[model samples]
Target: MTEFTLIPASGAAVPAEPFTGRHLIDGLWKDSADGATFDRVSPSHGVLVSRSAKGGEAEVLAAIAAARRAFDAGDWSFSSGKSRSEILNRVADLIDRDRERIARIEVLESGKPIAQARGEIEGAADIWRYAAALARMAHGDSHNNLGPDMLGLVLKEPIGVAAIITPWNFPFLIVSQKLPFALAAGCTAVVKPSEMTPSTTVILFELLEEAGLPAGVANLVLGYGDPVGAVMTTHPDVDMVSFTGSTGVGKRIVAAASGTLKKVSLELGGKNPQVIFPDADLDAAADAIAFGIYFNAGECCNSGSRIIVHEDVAEALTDRIAVLSRKVPFGDPLSDATQVGAIISDEHLGKIDGYVREAQAAGAKVVIGGGVLAVPGLDGRFYAPTVVAGVTPDMAIAREEVFGPVLSVLTFKTEDEAIELANNAAYGLSAGVWSLDVHTCLNFARKVRAGTVWTNTWMDGFAELPFGGVKESGLGRELGRFGIEEYLELKTVQMRVARGRNNWVAG
Candidate 1:
């Protein structure tokens, strides 16, 4: 296989765009009011990629006001579903058309492998199309027999302006998870993408505008979480907030939204488990579980960090996982051959390494790779795929969300013990189960407290699956019909067929 330690941006295979400090608001691209900016560097090489607008409270307010105005004007909120479908289709077409440019921007900032980045871009396109279909299929319930004298109709109405704050790890894909659904429900939105990776979202606005999306239907404000995210979450005009990030931040958003009692949908962190029964295909289970955690450098909130194997097969599965872990190529994100790329940044890389070291100090054994890997001629933030064994559920590495390429292997003596250990974490986002027996897989998955379960599979998600979590993992859901429901409110219309006014209240 061809290999290279580092390649200059000039020689990068992907096409480059003119990255700038512009955030779209009210259908116009403008500099932040204070003219301040933040540098966005490629995590692959720690080199400056572009300067982005560091929007603050002033911009946040402007965007919210714009969204509120657009909703109140009924420009998009009252449009025919067929018209909305056409617009959404055009938006998807643009995404597919510019997939290469968008994928390149995603890899540069988010540090995802080129192939995965491309996949995310294409996946987002599919989501847009699926959401378009949902727009046309927003069916409401009709009750013709509520009462002989009474007629009732339950209608779903838009929940007004939404504040969409997405995380750095799947910048474009995460936004697609929320934004398109809100639009499908005819809700206008003011979005705040992670400052670390705002290029793709900013570019997305250009496409939405080209798709004939009305001015202020969707707005993007780029900035850090504090002044920007905090303000947007609490903004009185914003009727809803859909956030995907840390559970800590998710809590703050809920608190901030309490003032307005706005609807909140949170897709947060997880310490997801991968359970392997003794009767499972150990080899296949090991490889799939390793990929579950290592995909996207293990920045996934649903990373299957807790690999709970039955005692009978724990040693063998752990060994197989170590072998699979080593084969994952960690290098330049632009390299098509690279399966694992750099961490989001230096600070994030340090946090990941710290977690691994702490786990090792607590009596956990480092199976294969446990530290950061170097890329010659460059100080890129790359961490090796790590497999740690002899871990207890009480260990911080097992309980916490590392969001890195580190796996903790724990053993269980019985199915009951495995279930207990898996549910010990404060998170319950998702889980995976592997077993040759269909009954075992189904029963075990049903017992897990997570939102989604994969029997004999891992890290598989589609636009049609309702994805979310219980407990502290998150609130509400995204994707499928449920995603659109989060942006709508139920209204009942009742009328008396007798045409006689009842004076019971007055009497």
Candidate 2:
């Protein structure tokens, strides 16, 4: 590995390393069939980081074929739990070995705060380790007690070649959430990281090979979603598809996968809510709300972009929110003090701006910062942390996933009204409740229609818990033992100890 330094969007530098930016197929690092490549640049700065192989249908097919071959060879997916555990553990070790460099690369690509980026790297390593332990413990069930003359068995088998497509924000963390479990379940995979930030996984390919993952056990293809993503979902050779992105794209993948009737798992969009009751600690609630919407520049599927406050405390909470929102330091992604960073791309920046502009045009008040920020030394996409007051539940800014540093505040006179507003959206990925009263918090958490509910907290996760959504948010879960099961197919086996007479009609 050659030493390199990445420049943040604000032109701050941090030591890093360069990735080959090549596709890993069948244990080989190769360019695209057409020899095409796309530049991978920092979201913090518009500077070129490297050029990654631009893949499409051909690359997708190759990756799927490689994954299928490996799964069929039984060197991986059909191997014993112990054998799988050894390789999975090795991968974990490699991740920790290169954690610092990986974190730097993530900041270079995603333009998230260095502190959060480092935390994600550590969390990803923990996930791999957790999966490694699970790999050794993946067991089937048996019931010899069925009868003296009979036995029953329930087996969990690998679902074969899995196609994993991840998004740009929290690229490595999200991929780790899916891939490690697939590996633990003894499945081979064809992975397509978002074109914007595929370098981390490209580096993982190198590490997986070093960890002795067999050829085709895990393949990496970097490219745009159009043809590559479509190929993965529609390809006959793929046994399953796991995707993390927008709800619209998730639906598209589902429609395409229906052609083959392949197993599909999606972690989609979220217009998540943070509901604060009058009995809550207003200051603490404001702090959590700030972190909720501004973490990763609010480019998270579970971002709490919708703020529903009790009418009694709405004005007070709004004041604290503005104060805390301004405290979110912004500048170099590599800077330790930076809490929020640049937007992922110009396209996404424009989308965020449009939402704010439209909301303002509709009579919403800009309580504080509400537009793009121009950093003196950076050419990256940066947006100010914005809070919109007088927001209605039906407003576009209040209803949609802003995926930026923007929060829309709404007021509710009753608990029923709060729950109604929170659950009104088409998304149900996650939500948060901040209240000192146990009953109030519990009631809101139970009534809110979301996959994950945090009481007196926001956005904390663990490897032992399942993460996903309901309704338009997603299909299927990831994380924990259940996550690994997403890559497994269950089969029931029955046997008779003694065979009696058989009927001739059976023939």
Model 1 C-alpha lDDT per residue in residues 134-225, reported as the tens digit of each score: 99999678888977788888999899999999999999999999999999999999999998999999889989999999999999999999
CA lDDT, every prediction? 0.88, 0.87
Q: Candidate 2 residues 1-507, lDDT tens each?
A: 101122334446643534559899998989999999888777776666767899978888998999998889887877888888888788888988998888888888888888898899889989988888888888889999987878899998999989999999988999999998999998999999998898888878888999998888999988988888889889899999999999999999999999999999999999999988888988888888988988988898988898999888888999998887766787678788788888999999999999999999999999988877876578778888889999987799988888998999999998898899999999999999988889998898789889999999898899999999998999999998888889989999998877773577877
Which residue pairs clash within candidate 2? 9-44, 9-45
Candidate 1, residue 163: the lDDT equals 94
Q: After superposition, how far is residue 121 of candidate 1 from its true place, in Å?
A: 0.4
TM-score of 1: 0.96
The residue ranges of model 1 lying beyond 4 angstroms of the native Cα positions read 1-18, 501-507
Lowest lDDT sum, 10 consecutive residues, model 2, at: 1-10
User: How far is each candidate from the true structure, as Cα RMSD in Å?
Assistant: 2.3, 4.1
